[model samples]
Target: MRPTITGLGPLLDQIGADTGMTISTLGVLAAVPLVAWALFSPLAHDLSRRFGQPRVLLWSLVVLLAGTVVRSLPGPVVSLWIGTAVIGIGIAIINVLMPSVVKRDFAGHVPAVTALYTALLAGFGAISSGVVVPISHVELGGDPAGWRIALLVTGGILLPFAIAVWWWAHRGRRAHSRSASQHGRTGIWTDPLAWLVAAYMGLQASMFYMLVTWLAAISMSTGRSEVVAGVDVMVYQLFSLAGSLLLPLVLRGRIERFAPALIPSLAIVGAAGLMLAPGAILVWTPLLGLSSGATLGMSLTLMAQRARDHDAASALSGMSQSVGYVIAAMGPVVFGWLHSLTGGWTASLSLLLAVLVLLTVVGVFAGRDRYVLDSR
Candidate 1:
């Protein structure tokens, strides 16, 4: 569900052409959601408290579907921004609340369920990237509106299941905010480890969004065709899926260990490869995929493990993603502008390499064996 918004990043070129916008303008489409997530993430706890998490999730799906329809509508550039922003807002709510649900429901198997969530997200995201062009051309019978058709069809498939899940979960449930602390069980606002977690999340999210937006185009710049480049993106996701599945076995629920450092370090190495040898995408793609996927799995796991209870999970999740996304919101726009300014890929790729380095350092702090509720 979250990956659907991300999948749109790789289609920026097509969107630009259709909307008669520049690359810089199209970059906004990718970053807009992050910005919205930043703004909306902190509000999740309040809404869930007032209306129940299950019901809130259903409304999120409804708004998400509406955003898709609005984006697919034939209109000027404004519709794209409006629709994308709406989509981002919906995703924000889900992102902030889902961790609490997982922490409460699957408390005994945090890493395993985190892995499952990552796998689903990465798998569908890869499918979205790989199929958009084919679905546009073949599924839509060569219509000029193929991209729009593809978006609608994908949303159509996901919406029903999303609705059913929320509907089932909401049975006999009601809002319960009468006596709960408004700030959740603890105050993570001043915790240094909390800041580290947010930094790790922001940095990793920046790199991930950058790849989703530029991977295919970057590969294509290396003399590969669009289809082949898209396949490379799929291959990356497959490796990511592997990493996600492996993370649970690697550390179980204990994340604050020396072994986890290898995850983001691997991403740093692969990112260096991307800068130096863009042509060998097949080689570096797996490295990035594996490490990035593991990093994501850990991030979600940490959101749960770093909190002692569901209330604290809600607080920490809201804080981590909100601040982190605000930091990440600049990635696509800055990356695209760098490419435009330099007229080459080297500068942009180098910047991402720097981000990966910072991601590794902060991830270590985030992986520490402490909970937000245990702080001073």
Candidate 2:
């Protein structure tokens, strides 16, 4: 999921060259999966209830692998869009279930576990972003479509291994034993606090995806090479890993209320830096990455903490991510459209700043330690 989100940044130009598509059109490619995420996220809890989490997750992995293969195949442009949507659907299921797993398995250690999960997400995303371009440069099989191979490697390579491990971990487990009655009803959709969480999730997700999809283009627009721009994204993701790893420490004290707002404030500085000093990308990219990583961890932690149990966590997770990603899916398209409309990145980046401001404001309220569906 991270690879699909972040790895494609550097390769967008090459893909555009191969497909004869404009950058703005390709921005829709980035959003396709996000749209799938929004559409499919809400179904995860129901799926889990029917087949159990492990089985559903295993099936999602298979779907993800298939999507990766389909999208990477060399042929009709429609395959790319189709495969991207499939990948989005697969990830959307996993995204909603992951928080529930943390809530169930690690009950008391939500923040710590979420931090580790998000840190690894950023770490793998960094590797994918950094290496996909260089991998495309490798003359494997004398393939002219090196970008396809790069996408395959980054997106599908580990899926088989993951599937094997998952199956082995829960081989004979009774997946179909769980019933709807075991998980109580949840009114997450109508809850104002849930909406706050969803808003924060959506806003942060928009900012993250916007950067994932366009930061390389933004860097290249400033006269950097594709490889250099890729490196910038890699560095940004590495710092995001750092931020994720550091979040547990930051949240250890009584600063929970302010941490949400405080962390995203860094993104304001980063977005401003991109606009004001495009030359100093290295300086600002880390700030953006850190903010993104920490805020993501915070958001996931909130999903877990704000629920009474794993069932509620899954429900809230599904709801928040479903609504959140609808908002997120718009980010890249809007950013690209803005750039195409204005003929520069200034307006596009200003949009990001405006998003960051909204993110900060929402984070303040969402960060309050309150459980969803709690009558208190």
Candidate 3:
């Protein structure tokens, strides 16, 4: 998730200042990984089949290291773009393969392992977003490139994790084998239920991302100071962590059709709270955070649970994330455009409400106890 951290608010502005990149250019920089995820995600299944999941994971870490170095090295604008794209590509591979890895290694311990996985990703992101400003204040070699140093420090912290993954890959080289015959005839894309899963993933993610983009502004609208509004965002993240940690217990074995619907109801409740109470973000932020975290956990868990095996897990992960994320990436942009056009938050909130309804409808189908391989 260093890739996600690298694109945080403080880091984005610092990178733009260091490289003379405009806001529009910075938006593209931020979007690079999502686009790369959409493009490269499906390939992870093929790559894993050929080289093994562990090996592919190891190499993706290597790409992350290289891209992290190149990206935050106080380079030219072009290098920044290239490095960001490289980092995005690396994360995309890991993104698609990790849930599959959980399916293979912790088949019996799915909930616990999935919670740990999701928590760590979100945790790192929160730390990065909060620390980048402070990190920017620190001088590295007297370079004053605090943003650059901040990213490098984050990447360096990942070195131990990379080494561990590499060790795992080298040890497991011959334990893996590929068999195309194992895959069922149904591609993930053709399944109606799979689309519901994808829609659930995308809509929830889009709502989360869209809220993250404007949460502070929304807070400030109610007369909160910038500092307080920022704290509100952090509070949302903390409760989100709580949500992920707890939701898995609720979804340990088979899922009910209403499990997914439960998550969006949190969002809908929070939205209603905001509209009804106004300026009382303190009251509803936690519910919204829990909804975001729990919803994401459900989506990731479904990627593994719905699959018949690691191959199917990878395929489902690839299809859902690749397509789902591309859809999610448009959310903030759409909201911003709506805000600009309507000159208020009503239109955007209305859109958010509409998505919540759609997600609820889709989650009813996605949350059913059906397997992806059975779709055909």
Candidate 4:
């Protein structure tokens, strides 16, 4: 999802008659997944229950691949929008189910699993952004259609992972059945803790997407070259991966209460860096990445810890992701619109700082080691 969407960095200039649109406009297009994620969030569990997770996941990958492949085909702006929407739908399904899978399969290790998953995902994002231009320029026969080839590579890359997931599912059928039967009575949607989990997920996602869609542009406006700006974005994500990996290890035993306060503090620094010393963003970007990535993993970890059983975990994951995505989907569009109206990124940066403040306030409550039920 990150690669497919964030890869727009190089293409933004190429969009629409080789005429460049503002970063805000590009942000709107890049953020389409937010809408799809919100819409698909509620259905993740239903789809899993109806077809089984393995089948649902398998198909989601296929859909994801198809969406990217079709978008790569040369066409007009409308076709690009259609392709983007399709990719969003595919990614939304995958994102919702991936957490539930970890919750079920690695019952005792949500933090570790989420950390690793996010780290690798962030790494993939880094690679995608770095190579987007190269792939478009050198690979795929060097045609404008080359962009399609570059985009399609991600879908192809996912095939092996999808196949492995299929194999893993075949072997885990017995465990899946047992877990399903056990969680049959309690519904996750009715739980208050579930709402907290979802809200955290949405808010974190909103910040991440907002940055992903605009960070490069922000750098460019600050006088960085497109290459440097892209590299800066890649560095941000690499640090995000590192943060995701390190935080779970660092916070493992220290999170006795409100460990989530760390997220907001980090966000504050990031906001300040973006607005105050745009040149020093390279330093601040990693701090933001670390804080945000760690928070995301922690949020996922909380879902499993809070839920009483696998069913509750799945339900919570779905609810949180669904509602969270809806809230998140608006971040890019709103950020873009705000920027367009203000004529500079300062207002947008300020808006993001406000978001970070909210994150900190919520993190104080959400980060407590006590389970969601205890808070209630």
> What TM-score does each of the candidates earn?
0.94, 0.97, 0.86, 0.89
Residue 259 of model 3: what lDDT? Answer: 80
TM-score of 1: 0.94
The local lDDT score (0 to 100) that residue 128 gets in candidate 2 is: 95
**Model 2, span 249-302: residue lDDT tens:** 888678977888999888899999999999899999999999999999988998
- Supply the global lDDT for candidate 1: 0.79
lDDT of each: 0.79, 0.90, 0.73, 0.73
Clashes of each: 0, 0, 0, 4
**Shift of residue 225 alpha carbon in model 3, Å:** 6.1
Q: For model 4, what is the error of residue 190's alpha carbon versus the real structure, in angstroms, after optimal superposition?
A: 4.4
Candidates 1 and 3: which is better by lDDT? 1
Residue pairs whose backbone atoms clash in candidate 2? none
State which candidate has the highest TM-score. Answer: 2
Choose 1 or 4, whichever is better by TM-score: 1
What's the CA RMSD for each of the models? 1.9, 1.4, 3.1, 2.9
How well is each residue in 1-376 modelled by candidate 4, as lDDT tens digits?
5677767654555553343556566777777777887887677777777777777777777777677766777655566667878888888877877777787888877778888998887888887777665665663344444556666674356655765777676755532333364232244556666666777887888888788777877888889876677777788788888878986666656653566766558778888888888888888899878877777777777777776666666677777888788878888888878888988888888878887777777777776545433335
Off by over 4 Å in 1: 139-142, 183-186, 252-256
Candidate 2: Cα lDDT at 290: 96
